[model samples]
Target chain A: MNILNGSAYPNNGVHLNKRHRKAKLFSMLCSLVTWLGVALLGVLLYQVSSDGFKWLDLQFLTSFPSRFPYKAGIKSALVGTLWLISMVAFIAIPIGVATALYLEELSGQGRMNRLIELNISNLAGVPSIVYGIIGLAVFVRGLALERSLVAGALTMSLLILPVIIIASREAIKSVPMSIRHAAFALGATRLQTARDHVLPASYSGILTGVILALSRAIGETAPLIMIGALTYVAFLPEGPMDSFTALPIQIYNWVSRPQQEFHQLAAGGIIVLLAVLLMMNTIAIVIRYKTERKYK
Target chain B: MTMGTFRLVKKDCINNRGTRWGESLIHCGLALCTLISIVTTFVIIAILAKESFGFFEEVSPVEFYFGTRWVPLLEPSSYGVLPLVWGTLSVTFGAALIAIPIGLASAIYLSEYASHRVRSIVKPLLELLAGIPTVVYGYFALTFITPLLKTVLPEIQVFNALSGAIVVGIMVLPMIATLSDNALRSVPDTLRQGAYALGATSYEVTTQVVVPAGLSGVMASFLLAISRAIGETMAVTLAVGATPNMSFTLLESIQTMTAYIVQISLGDTPAGGIAYQTLFAVAGFLFLITLLLNVLSQWFLNRYREVYD
Candidate 1:
């Protein structure tokens, strides 16, 4: 239409302006959609903080749960969470890192090796509750471990093992092939190279990954619930075999109760959970950045 | 001289019995360690097969699948799983409805528009969403979201599907956004430049060129997120109602398969009873559904995967 008239420049200007306006509006809409996640986080934090602060006190952190919300505390839950995480870390790190090392370095590309790789990825995708069922059968009944911290920790180790292995593989994979070859050229054995150079260089990456996986393990409730972690435990675990209740289970128990105070207590429990999660994530991020700088 | 040095090194490597012995031992150990995952899968399948088969023996497969009700605890129990399936699907459907568009849009913005500074800030913050415990999300739903929704929809029940679905959607948003962002970013820069050279707008370039190129990955992300929502137990157990009703209404209380598992587990059902068998049966069904979706996601990822180096 503009080509037909030699002096139709102004009309074309208006047409392009219309399109530009529509495009700008559409882009703005996309930005709004992008903010949905941030918006949800904002609301969640605000809601929890508002309800949590009033109930969050030293006493609340130190005392045991009571029928009276005013007297209830998360001492047992906090202690149990710490015990569970420590046990999980103890059980998962060595095996997870070893599996990654074998698959990435030592193992040949055999059919069996490929099978292990496929199984690990598939296991990573399996639901946590299924892991719980396995725990119920193997740990609780088959092994006769019962609903103890040891069983829960062992189950969680299984749940997070694939995650840690996958992450460690990524970390190990990032180490330059030149570094290992250089070590080999210097008469360092494969084991010596991996131990002396490769493992040291990738240690931070492995740590960050393990920390992140442990954070995920900490928040896990389903498998633990499936394995029948006690919800009303008023005492802290004294040993690995002792029965335990985690923060998530404690919060779940509280939320189910009909009392308004218990709901407040649940909110308070969330604040603690979020804080622990945030701290772990912060440490992971710091480790990741530091390692990245060193490597690069 | 170089050959002599090489021979000495080779001899040293060959003669290091301790190192050779230790290395082989370590290799065997690690290889055995890696087999744990395979054993775990076998154990899960064995347990599910054994227990679910028990359930099927007691309650016929025809009735279990075709029956409309799922009341295992009540007298004269009905084994129809449709109600539980309906409950689970409705929540999943609701979550997908809420997650897909917003997640895609967020992916587009992050991949196509956000500067590095903004991307770094926003990306981690979004991940923090995934990092928060689901139990907290459940608490948030029960306490905050439900009350907030009550203002808008006065008739909504305290334990309705809407709140659970919305929170699950939020929980899933990070997975979709992050995965889809990677997908969108994987689209070659040349494609965007080609679209721009054709005088396409930014939105058009994204929706038509980049998104189409990255469709499988985006679709894979959706599949993965749906599987996640289906298997999610705690938040749904808390926010979605526990009653095993046949109704699909978002406002009514309903129980999902995961929720039902939690219900039976929480109750003191006698060991090796029918109630116990139902837990395994429901879990087996849930496992199959999630496993199918996961395999589908992996297939899409491998089949349509693009490499632009």
Candidate 2:
């Protein structure tokens, strides 16, 4: 309040101050709520490290899971996740990007494209576990893929397709129309314009989106669980056709065990899982930084 | 025109003609890739329909939908799915109870109060929290949260819906916070300035002006987060018991639809049996519920969104 206005309206000072005080207090409460999330993360990190740090060793990385917690490791799960994600990447990226290109550059604003857009958004909202239901029915049962690594890969590809497509479409959309117009003016077809000019310009953005989405796929357990990936495995997956387990699956298996030591192993597995996720995210962030700076 | 220019133009037309045919074919192929998502949806519907058709043929739809008990593994199994539905709803409700206020408050702080430096650090860190695997959340719930709850609330079971709710709430917090933050931020600065010029306090501007403007987005986030909580599997499966108890008590063990499906997959439940069919049926219901919520959320976001350029 202005000093002259406050003097003219005597009680206004106390009332205005009260309102300001309430606003300050409310802002503080909001800040506290924000920090609550950080507190949760801190406590969780502390909990996992304290319980499982001793078990996170070289042997833990290399050895196969055993009935005994002392010998149990995430070896099979690690390799299996590697196999799954590689196939997922190999299968999903091209198809997803192609879909994004079709929708963003070619389809334009047609009714069909709108339907597809709406469908993808709906698909993105479908729970990961429901995708597992399809994976179970179509791949595991119908195709008789029998929980193979490739089966898991295909399932995950379908699950993440909507996300990848959405992200890539956003990336493609960010490539302004002027670039495409320039190419077209130079006698290039729409395809040529998109491929030679737009795609290259948006590559980093698409890569970041892909990495972030794949990182999400890494942490997903429900669909893999729904497809009946084998939890108990002594050996690693030999090939795409072999049965496989993943990081989340192994963590789930260990967690469900009644033993306290198994929970600890689960924590160890989580640390590894989170490390992989963050590593990918870090790559995405670095690429984003490089791209942002380049554009600037 | 000169013969040289005419010949060059002719060659260009031929090249364009050749590439145009190839381009259309490439376009169709890319279009097929886009159609794959639609195909996935149809395939999901078809598989659930074909498998669940048998179950519906055997058990009356009314009984399956309205029945309270859900004992698929045991002989003389009651096929009532209300228990599972109740379980899913109760956990989702409980999770919303924990997530909404905290999420809304955090979103306000993020969009309104936080400095750019704080946001730069906190936002990505919040995403990291969201990125954590559900299985790990399950483990945390089992190893940490349930035990901690037990210290004060001794009556709580080792595997109870309460802890399941807490973990699910944590799991979805980032989505609510991030989406609502975007919503609030999208409410243009002019509105806040107008309120401030009218002598409204910052809190009044935020709670009254900014929040009302972004209500649709906040509501959409809530819907999506609730849907996610319903569909969450490993955490609920691990944190909550497998007992399909119809009682809605948070302290007691109950099984969600997701947890029930996981239970079937884990057990030696004979494939192609009624029990297995029940998995499809339950999953079908889950698909519908989440699908409806997703569509509604999308509709709300598109319909009511204030596009301030």
Candidate 3:
């Protein structure tokens, strides 16, 4: 009886050891899979950056596109992108901020406010191409903006407006109620209190959110594609009504072509886009950090 | 007389007003913009409905809806939307299949398992994946992922749905991970502690207690991710072949609705033709699907209210 019990003990111990090993193996496998995803992203980034660096020069940055691959540059696309960003920012910021302020300060938690809030959140997640369709119908076709930079910009403004509103509301809500009450006690009206006391305090956060949204707008390609941004504009758009191409559109056009040189050019265009996005995001981060420090 | 007049003027200046017109004006302005945005959506739907009506006048609604063939440019062209819808679903499902597991795992690892240092390094790196433009992902899908897949599955077409789905899955990983992490972090610590006190494994606790608590948020994230995958344009356009086949084999190339839109937008279709009008009709369909998903996500978030406080 003693011998049999001792044998069962070893068997049970082996089974427990195997279970422990299985758990470890499973966890290790999961970790490895996660690393694989990260590694794939890293490798893709490296390839693009490396290939892109070969053609990334001041001339590549400043010159206009040419038929020759060596001489082709992204001047028109860059200017177009900048113009689009500016217009989108101009159109979206005021509306977004006002909507945010209204939601957070003015409106009571009633059905209308709740409905608007829900709509804004839903609109924020609507795929951008849907916005393109809306733009095509309303801006291009109905309003006869006719494939202009303004049409693209307006479309993009609508696209990111919800994001701006949501972020701005969060920023505004973060401001202490005490400050507003103090201003009110000092005989300031609600509007004056919000403008002078609340807005200034929330300015950094609002700016950060707006900048990030604009950064996203800058990288967008689908809506521009839908609204008929040119694929190969030789000259820069002098005004918002002029036909234009953006960096992503140019990159897409190049990459789609069955040529090795065009592929390199596409990579270069991507690098430029990444630089623009990185710059905007960095500024946003800096502002957020500064705001946090100031508040603290 | 001068002192009496001054006192009378001072007393007259005591009149006050409540809720200034300026505040009212600001609210009106916000209301106007919101009104415009809402009206714009309605106008789009109107235009889409009008054009789609015109399209159906040319073809039959029954054929467009249920017919399997989609030859829009051929002799006696059939405008069946099933092929495009099938392509959209298959690619989206493939992407969700890849993204859900990998993204959830990454979120779990970052929120529960990884150290703060690892999380800080990993999270931003993951976000960097998102910041990479979709067009770049298109290029990578075409140049890199396709070739990589071809090596192992030599029979795979160069511009197959699998490659597009994989690339899209990668593109949406950050969005899912970020949202799911937020959900996971919102789960209270007491539940985890209770599980630990019961001698449960960390994995068991995460799977059973924490994940269940965060299930709504997780579902919301998945829905959003799927919406994104469905609406994706560039990468799929570049990688997935423009063929409007309805086959489920990932090895074969297929055309999604967004790709078809991009295809027409690339200028083969003339303005005011059936094709151009069809773009709007298809866009309307795409819009409705995403809108439903977005509304569902919001409803789930509100309904769950998983926050302990």
Query: Which candidate gets the maximum TM-score versus the true structure?
Result: 2
Model 2: per-residue Cα lDDT over A129-243, one tens digit each: 8899889888888899987987899999999999899999998988877888889999998888889998998998999999988988898998998888889888877888999
**After best superposition, candidate 2 residue A12: deviation in angstroms?**
6.8
Q: Which of candidates 1 and 2 is the stronger one according to lDDT?
A: 2
**Model 2: per-residue Cα lDDT over B1-309, one tens digit each:** 134323333433344446477776776677678768878888888888888889999999999999987877777878999999998888899899999999999999999999999999999989889888888889889999999999999999999999999999988998899999999999999988977776777888888789989989999999999989988988999999898887757999999999999888887666788888998999899999999999999889989988787
How do the residues B188-230 of candidate 1 rate in per-residue lDDT, one tens digit apiece?
9998897677666686677777888898899999999999999
Question: Could you give the candidate ranking by lDDT, starting with the highest?
Answer: 2, 1, 3
Q: Each candidate: RMSD to true structure?
A: 6.1, 6.2, 7.8
Interface RMSD of 3: 8.7
What tens digits encode model 3's per-residue C-alpha lDDT throughout B137-162? 99999888998999999999978999
* CAPRI grade, predicted model 2: medium
Can you tell me which runs of candidate 2 are displaced by over 4 Å?
Answer: A1-14, A293-296, B1-19
User: What's the CA error at residue A272 for candidate 1, in Å?
Assistant: 1.0
TM-score of chain A of each: 0.92, 0.94, 0.88
Model 3 segments more than 4 A misplaced: A1-30, A293-296, B1-19
CA lDDT, candidate 1, residue B192? 86
Tens-place lDDT digits, model 3, residues A1-296: 22223442356455656645654665666566667778978789788987788999999988888778899999999998988888898999988898787677755566566766777777787777878877877788779999899999999999999989999999998998888889999998766787898989999989999998898898888888988888889888888898888888889888888888888888999988988888888899898887762542
How close is every model to the real structure, measured as TM-score? 0.93, 0.94, 0.91
Name the runs in model 1 displaced over 4 angstroms: A1-18, A293-296, B1-19
DockQ, 0 to 1 scale, candidate 2: 0.54
Candidate of highest lDDT: 2
